[model samples]
Target: MKRFIITEDGSHSLFSAQFNQQYHSLQGALNESEHIYINLGLRPALENGPVSVFEMGFGTGLNAFLAWKLADQLQKQVFYTSVEAYPVSMLEASQLNYEEATGEKGFMQLHHAPWGKETGISPFFYLRKEITTLQDFTPDRFFDVIFYDAFDPQAQPELWTEEIFTKIAAQTKPGGVLVTYSSKGIVKRALAAAGFAVERHKGPGRKAHILKAIKL
Candidate 1:
């Protein structure tokens, strides 16, 4: 069963018994997403113009929500694609407090949006949520930014292998960026083996460093 827990920043995060992990950092779900994925990943990609983002996990919909909000704020168009094998139920999604915390409406709309089809969340943001695992996913288009938000190596080692990273890298445009809240040596090695120039950056709360890799 999955349950909600409040992080240090007072944001709601889901605790997954199946994965034996929480969707976001226990320190702060909102803070972690904004810092690693938004600040380090999405923001830089948008500077190049209209951006296409690919996310590995769409657990709480927090990242997508923030991306949509930022795209609207910047008046930049974003085509967001995310793949999730297991999706959060609407009941579980409704319990999340992102809308309340961010003072942003549309949290529910994101959850309510149909899967496997492009849904326009706003004039600036279009989302397509795929119901599949990373192993089975084939990219239809290359992406500018990839949010590698999978479970930790301890939980989902297969997803962290070089084979997986290579598959993801194959669909990333040259110079495109991929960000994650993990700096594990295996991850760095796998990304490097997959042809990305990896860099370590200061992480949000508790974590010492996170990784940002650019497709070569």
Candidate 2:
């Protein structure tokens, strides 16, 4: 079972008993999503007009919420597809404080959207939550951005391998970007091996660096 814990920034994240890892940063879940996923991934993708985004982990629905909120605020269209092997239960979802912080409605609807079919949650946001893992997922279309928000390499190294990223690159368009909070050397090597022109970016809070790998 997953348990919710309040982080340093007064936001709640799940502590996964199975993985023995937190779904997000204990420093601040909200800010972490905003910084790494939104500011880096979504915003840049929006520059190229309407965007199709693929996310690795749908964890707390926080990333989707932020994307939906930003798409609405920017008056841009977004088609978001997120893959997760395991989903958070309604009880765990209820304990999250993200909606309050974001001041955005429809978070519940995003979570409630039926898997395997694309659902229009808002005028600007269309979501398709896939109940699968990266290894098993096949893309329906190439994405403008990929939010590679999987667990740390220490916990789930298989997901961060070159083979997996090569699969990811196959579904990414030329110049499409993949962003993640990890700056580990092996991670960058894997990304490069998979055909991305990787760049390091300033990380949020105490994190030293984050990575943005572009398919060039």
Candidate 3:
């Protein structure tokens, strides 16, 4: 079962009983997404022109919501495709306080968008939420940015393996980038082994370091 919990920053994050983990940082869900994903991941990728983004886990649609908010502000078009083996229920998503926190209503539409097909929430934002896992996902078009937002290796080690990163790297466009909230040595080495020139960046809140890897 999944339940919502308020973080230190007064934002909601999901606590997954199956994984025994909180989907986002305990400090603040919205803050972590904005800093790690929107700032470090999506913002820099926009410099490359219109971007296609692939997210590893669409746990609560927070990252997608933030991406849409930023993309709309910049008048940039974004095609976001996020993969999740187990998606959150409508009730669970509704319980989230993201809309109130971000002061944006697009967050609701993002959660309501149908899975397995593209849906446009705004003129600049298009989303396709895939009901699958990264291991089984095959992209028809390579993406400019990949948000590797899976649970920590401690909770789900298989998704953090080199073999999986290698498969994902194949779908990353040359010069494209992959960002994650993890700076584990193995994670960096796996990304490097898979063809990314990885770099470490300052993390949000309690996190010490995060990773940004450019596909080469």
Number of the top lDDT candidate: 1
Error of 3 at 144 (Å): 0.6
Which of the numbered candidates is closest to the native, going by highest TM-score?
1
What's the TM-score of each model vs. the native? 0.99, 0.98, 0.97
Clashing residue pairs in candidate 3 (N, C-alpha, C atoms within 3 angstroms)? none
Lowest summed lDDT across 10 adjacent residues in model 2 is found at 99-108
lDDT of each: 0.95, 0.92, 0.91
Which residue ranges in model 1 land beyond 4 Å of their true spot?
none
Candidate 1, backbone clash total: 0
Cα error, residue 200 of model 2, in Å, equals: 0.6
Q: Per-residue lDDT tens digits of candidate 3, residues 80-128? A: 9999999998888888999898888857798889999999888889999
Candidate 1 at residue 117, lDDT? Answer: 96
Off by over 4 Å in 2: none
Instruction: Compare candidates 1 and 3 on TM-score and give the better one.
Output: 1
Comparing 1 with 2 on TM-score, the higher-scoring candidate is 1
Candidate 2's residue-wise lDDT over 1-216, tens digit each?
798888777878899989989999888888899999999988988987999999999999999999999999998999999999999997778778887877767678878899999999889999999999889998989998999999999999999999999999999999999999999999999999999999999998898899999997
